[model samples]
Target: MNSPDVSALEITSSQACRVALRGPELIIEAANKAFVRSAGRDGFLGLPGWEAFPELRGQGYLELLDQVYRTKKPFVGLKMPILFQPSKGAPMEEHVTDFIYRPIEDGSGHVTGVFIESYDRTEWARA
Candidate 1:
C-alpha cells in the first residue's frame, strides 16, 4: 500500500511528535528516531503489523487505531498506562506521559495509514 513519505513531514514532527507511518497492513513505513528509542527497538523500519508493538497488543491500542481509521479523526491519549517488557525481570508497566494517533489521509480523503506519538512515563531510569 502506498503511504506518505516520512521525509514529507515537517521537522517538528521529527523532534516533538515522535511520529511514524504504518502502511495498509500496519507495516511500519517510517519512524523518526524518537520513536525508535521510545519503543526500545533499534531497527523499527519495515516491521509488519500492529502486533510488532507488543505493548500495544490487546491494550486498547488496536481498538483505538480502528476507531481512528474508521472515523478519520485524530486522537490524543494522556496518562495512559503503557506496559513494557523489563530488561531484568518480568514485564513492567508505566503510565504513558502522552500519546497521539492520527489517521493519514490519502488524496481522496480516505484513511491509508496512521501517525503515532508516544512519550515514556518513566523518570530518570531509577528502576
Candidate 2:
C-alpha cells in the first residue's frame, strides 16, 4: 500500500475557511470566498443569522458546529452533501459535497471561530 502526501497543499476542491465569534454574539467574521459563493450570499463578515440558511436547519451541521464552537477544533465534511439556498427567481438550488473546517483563534488562543471550506467534488469526479 502507498501513503498519501502529508505536506501537500491541494486546491482540488472549492474550499471554505471561515472565522467568527461564538455565543450570544455569534458573529461570522470571515468566510473564504468559496464559502461566500457556496453559501450563495455575500458580506458574511457579520452574523448573517442561521435562519438565513434555512437549509441547514435540523441537519448534522448543528452537531458539528457545536463541537467546533466548544472545542475550537477543526471539523471536516468528507463527501458531505450540501444544499445552497437559491436567490429569488432562481430555478433551482446549488449543491456541493465535501468540505473542511479549520478553526481560527486569537493571539491568546481562545476558541474563536472556524474556517469553512467547500470542495466541489463534481469537478474531480467527472475527471
Candidate 3:
C-alpha cells in the first residue's frame, strides 16, 4: 500500500489556525497565519506558550498542555469560551471555539511537541 502524502496534510493544516510547540516549555516552533492573527501579538514566535499569552497563564491551558505532553494524549475541546486581547493594549474579547491539542512524537516513540488547531465559533454561539 502506498503511504499518504505528508504535504497534503501540511496543506490542510495550513488553512486552519494552528501552531506547533516544542519541548516541555512549549516553545513556539511554527504557526500558520491564522494562528498568528489569533495570538494578537508580535514577537511570540520562539517564546514559551505562557509567555506568548501571559493573560492565559491562569486559565488552565498551560496545565492542559502539560498533561498532554506528559501522557502523550490528545485533547479536544468543543465550544469553549476564551478571552483574549485582539491587539496589544486592547480590551479582551470573548470567543467561543473548538480546538485540539495533539501530541507529536518522534521515531523513538517519545513525545516531542504538540500540535494545536483551533476553530472559532463565537458568531455561531451568539446566533
Candidate 4:
C-alpha cells in the first residue's frame, strides 16, 4: 500500500471540520484530522466506507452513499444521525451532523469518487 501524503492530509485537515474522499468501490482514500477526531481512530485509507464504519450499514447511510455514487448526484443531509465508536474498543455514540456527498468527476465527466464535507451538529441538536 502507498503511504498517505502527510502534507496533503495536513492541508485538508486545515480546510474543513470533517472531510473525506471515497474513491471507486467506496474505498476511503483520504480523511482529515476532524474526521479522525469524530471517528475516534485513524488508518481508514483504502477501506470501504461500510467496512470502515460497520455501524453505518444498517443506518441507511450505506444505501445512501451507494445511491449517490450510482447516480452520480450529490446528497445533502441535515442533522443526519451517525453512530460511531469514539475509540477503538469503546462504546459507540450517536452524533448528529450536516453533511454533503458530492460526486467527483474526472476529465471525461465520469464520476470517479465522492467528496464528503461535514459538520458535527450533535450539540445543536441537543439544544
Which candidate number would show the highest lDDT if scored against the true structure?
3
Per-residue lDDT of model 4, residues 1-127, tens digit only? 2223234555374545544455667888778777777788887888898888887778887787777777887899999888877887898899898988777666566666677778889999999
48: Cα error in model 3, Å:
0.1
Model 4 residue runs over 4 Å out of place are: 1-17
TM-score of 1: 0.73
Model 3: which residue pairs collide?
none
Query: What ranking emerges by lDDT with the best candidate at the front?
Result: 3, 4, 1, 2
RMSD, one per candidate, in order: 4.5, 7.0, 3.4, 5.3
Clashing pairs in 4: none
Q: In candidate 3, what are the lDDT values of residues 1-127, reduced to their tens digit?
A: 2212223256245657887888999998778778777777668879998887887777778899999999987899999988888888889898998999888787667788788888989999999
Best by TM-score: 3
lDDT string for model 1 (73-122, tens) is 78898777767653324466664557788888776767877877677655
Per-candidate TM-score against the hidden true structure: 0.73, 0.64, 0.88, 0.84
- Clash number for model 2? 10
Choose 1 or 4, whichever is better by TM-score. Answer: 4
Candidate 2's displacement at residue 38, Å, is 2.7
lDDT of candidates 1 onward, in order: 0.64, 0.54, 0.80, 0.74
Residue-level lDDT tens digits of model 2 in 1-127: 2212211133223344333434433466545555566556665456544644556666677567667767766777776655556553455554546766555555566655554555667556546
